[model samples]
Target: MPDWNRRSVLATGAALSTTGILAAVGSTVAEEDASTEGVATGDPPGWSSVHGNAANSRYLPLDDGFPEPNTIAWRSDTLYGVSNDGDIAVVDGRIYIVGEFESTDYEQTELRVASTDDGTLEWKTEVTGRQRPTVADGTVYVSGVDRVTAFDTEDGSLQWVREFDSEQWISNATAADGEIYVVTGGTRFNADATLYALDGEDGSIQWKRKQVEARQENRETADPAPVGFKSAPVAVANGSVYAITGGGEFKGSGSKPGLQWNGGVTALDAKTGEKQWGVVLEDGAFIKIIATDAFVCVQNMPDGLEETVLDSETGETVLTSNSTRAATADVRVTHDTFRPSSGPITVSTYGTDDSWTASDIYYFPPLIAGDTLIATRTSESSIVGFDLESGTEKWNWEFDGTPHALAGVDENTLYFKLYKADRPTELIALRASDDRGEGREGDDRDETEPDDDTEDGSDESDSDC
Candidate 1:
């Protein structure tokens, strides 16, 4: 494994993490017959977004229209090798993937797009090594060291690349109304953040909104610091994009006199990149974020202080729970690492621990189709899925390796990459509907159970499932 920090031009710190305060709010709905409402409604379409549709719900909701685990027709081999922290895009019956491989110099970071039907080589594009990639409007968008690039999804050609001035490595982009809205410096600690809207047709800056970091620049100073995104920008209803940036960056050293971090949510006009509304949250406050067509869920910390249902259009706090923030905050939430991949051969592994020892925390954004939510954890090595709406362990699968990404071709099937942390570098497909069972009438236990067995011969412990 290549040490990611050494090759950085700027401070390439940790991945995104969301820590929130809450008293364990219960899942809103119980298990009844699941419906395909917010999830994808059409036939065998390719998995596009990180959460598969801006809603970020990892659910694929293929109502009796997907392949079972027994029917994997083919797979493909990657160039240089495979990586856990990559993604796939499918279009026009072809599968496109950004697979990381070991270079001749032993540095890790490369990307390739393969075919989904037979796992054949389509086109390959190399990137600076990041996990989440958003594909839309016939272009594949990937973020590298200090830049974001758009690739022709069909032939893997470079359409355009826009490099940022600052080294604040940030989160993925959310596309709405033919525009890509993303955050820069949302991941690096104490780094100033700027929200950018990029043109989908060509990689051009449409508009930008800057948020000042309170702390001074400390990259070369004697002081040290821990880096992270205070809040990730999310998409709301109407023609708006919502996210929480900072009053400024936080300093690791306690000697600073200024505020550590200023938290707030800014709503921007999706089409024009105009500032519609902005609110600065209280200090040490964590936002419980969920955006729907009708409402945006912004709940605060420890006492679960305020779970507000804001009007998606007006940005008005329509309703409030008035609870305090929870004690253990919700970790930063983002898109799932992996979606469905296409290639010649697909092989991967998984792991789950009741101990919650994973490095990356994942949440299935509320699947617009019928409120089905999915989540998982990926660390040095492991993968586990839980129902987002109910917090029930759906299926827990473990392996002796680290998986960087996961996605669903259909609700019944899933795809993932097992990095070289504890296992071989390869991709694998599994039965995503393993925990799926017919919902009983009026029973509403809407929980998924563990499967009897797996494709491989390893026996799994069902306790975590």
Candidate 2:
């Protein structure tokens, strides 16, 4: 039997319906005096969205006079493990992450904020979902299983929440031009999905992209395929939102029963959810999206080993490579040609030396921090930093828990999401330093003083647990 019918259509589809519980759930507070002007003060340069900024170029350009790589800044005093529960966002000197902490007696999803200066807990509040928190214009937006919640960056107070129907769930979200762009998936594989453009301030449904609607119009006498997205959107960039479609199919009482799912990329206007262009991708088990200004990369696997690159504005094939990158249900990333991946990294020194290749990496992209490339080990809870120029390992950190590169705040500091078996999840920040004793200072950036500022930054602070 079909998982749903026209009735299931209530939850899915891009109707301009106010189908959500629109309300700001908490006390409305005034802006903090932290900003010199009315603008949120301390909202200096830092990572604010999934891949950091609209271009999604995971790269953070550093200042010339900053410290070296791998210095431990501070880890959240709360030792919760943050693995895949959520991603991070940094703005106004505050780092934000979402995680669901569950125990025998307690279970809750929290949006956590800490001071970037000291890793001091600023405030944490119960929230709805555990996707990457998108911080912009002093508000933090989070996507959960079925709803999108917005909280104030100042105190974690609720600003607004938009609850979608029970059958639909948020896959990924990013903010651009004061609007929130979201891609949602259906509970069942064939249940069809939707793309939504929502107002950032009050959670209003500005418009919803009607893929199914368009399909229905075209097939007036036939059964229209519901728009499905196992994972839809890349990030909002260049005034456009990019997404990959699982390509809908009908299995019962339809013209195309058991229709094979087609893989493809769709680009929509960021302001208006209208289709700008789309290109079909090869049928693959998993499809991931990596977008740069010049091209959109569709990877066949999470490691980006088999991939296709399409022109960003026009759906023209520009290039192709073997690959994939991380996608929860298979999809995610940035601009710039230098995307770090799980494949062996062969760095060229261009000198009287042979190039070095780092191997056995997990099938995820490494976090790029200027000249230092941070890669996670495949089998253990370890992260290694390599000098791009010398093509050599500069430092590394082995943690008791696994860590995912979360953000590069500046040239000097980077943040990570750490996860252990049964622990809830936590975020950690590290400062890059050039000075060390004798050997490599490749140690986990943990237990360092909040105010540590020295040549070595006193590696004694590294508990290495």
Candidate 3:
């Protein structure tokens, strides 16, 4: 196995999810009952943003949906992939996606709104963005190369555009509690990075935090390697902001050129930008992290490494392991679900010392929704759900189109990108059951079709959907 790092992961356009290390082998496909229970009807849960929420935990706290969906809800017509920045954002009864359609020249960028109740196109707006769109407080925020643009949910109209100068590059923008937290930095080594909190109503910086650490080195021995937050993504939850801070380049025996080392997770006060606590790695750097209100999970190095779970409030090791290896974090939350190539799904949680390893071909991101673990495999076009604790196979829903990425989950529906070879991709929704009888009563919203306005939300691109 190769030593994995951030640069290698980014180059592949995929992430080796932080779940436990594994070797997949035997394959099983069974039609199991995906019965769902306990739905709060007045309002169904929505994926709303990346990794389920601002915390980026990937853990959607919904009791109504079955993680192992056994039926298809609806599928969108062939949709082309544009310069995608993030996954689909589910809000209210509508889903917002960034893509292109019927564009042979690839110049126009479109943001389409559709009903999750059934895949109905509600409205389309010309928008500029790359990462996953974030819907918050009636607005959809999209971050691109030069600026961060906002669009209204009601009619997909232009809300605002926050542009930056040439020296500073916008990394990512996450919204929470009426404020959008953004990170901007220079790509060069040892460059300064800044985090800005912006107002949700308009593109205005509320507060900015710039924390820079100088390179520390021995004049006669090692090179100066500056380390800080750089351009890493953050998790915001419960009045706290968490980021994996590291920097520069290392020349260890088999070290890669563009990868950073000596990095770990750091927690800061969300409201004040004050540093709270941090756990820096001394041996190997962190691969990924997931932050929840209860715990923060970190996935570290060496290809076959396990998981590490830490208490969110304190920078303390709370994981109890019976194995010879240390614990891991972040695997339980949302991840860029990837195929492990070969490995049995080895899963363990922090709550109990007992663990289980289930035989499966590929283990994508371990998204724990209620009691079901929503997993995907690359062997065949299939989505499988496993019993979160017992590792029991729930259901394997296969499709002819290739499944790209797991966007988000809402109520009983799982939204993802599916593409056919040489043809444009499609937006697919999978459900736990075939009948709407499992859905909460009144889960459907009052339908309204707004006159979509192209070029309405675009800043530097042509509007065509």
Whole-model lDDT per candidate:
0.42, 0.53, 0.54
lDDT (Cα, tens digit) per residue for candidate 2, span 143-254? 7777887777886656677777644558656666677777776532432666777777777776665463213211336553444454444565555677665553321121
For the record, the alpha-carbon RMSD of candidate 1 to the native fold, in angstroms, is 17.7
TM-score leader: 3
TM-score for each predicted model, relative to the true structure: 0.54, 0.67, 0.70
lDDT of candidate 3 at residue 292, scale 0 to 100: 62
* Candidate 3 lDDT over residue span 201-304, tens digit each: 77655555555222222122444333466454577765667765655343212133454345555666555455555554432234345666557666544332
lDDT of 1 at 448: 24
lDDT by residue (tens digit), candidate 1, 328-358 = 1121122222233111110111111122222
Model 3: lDDT of residue 187: 44
lDDT score of residue 422 within candidate 3: 61
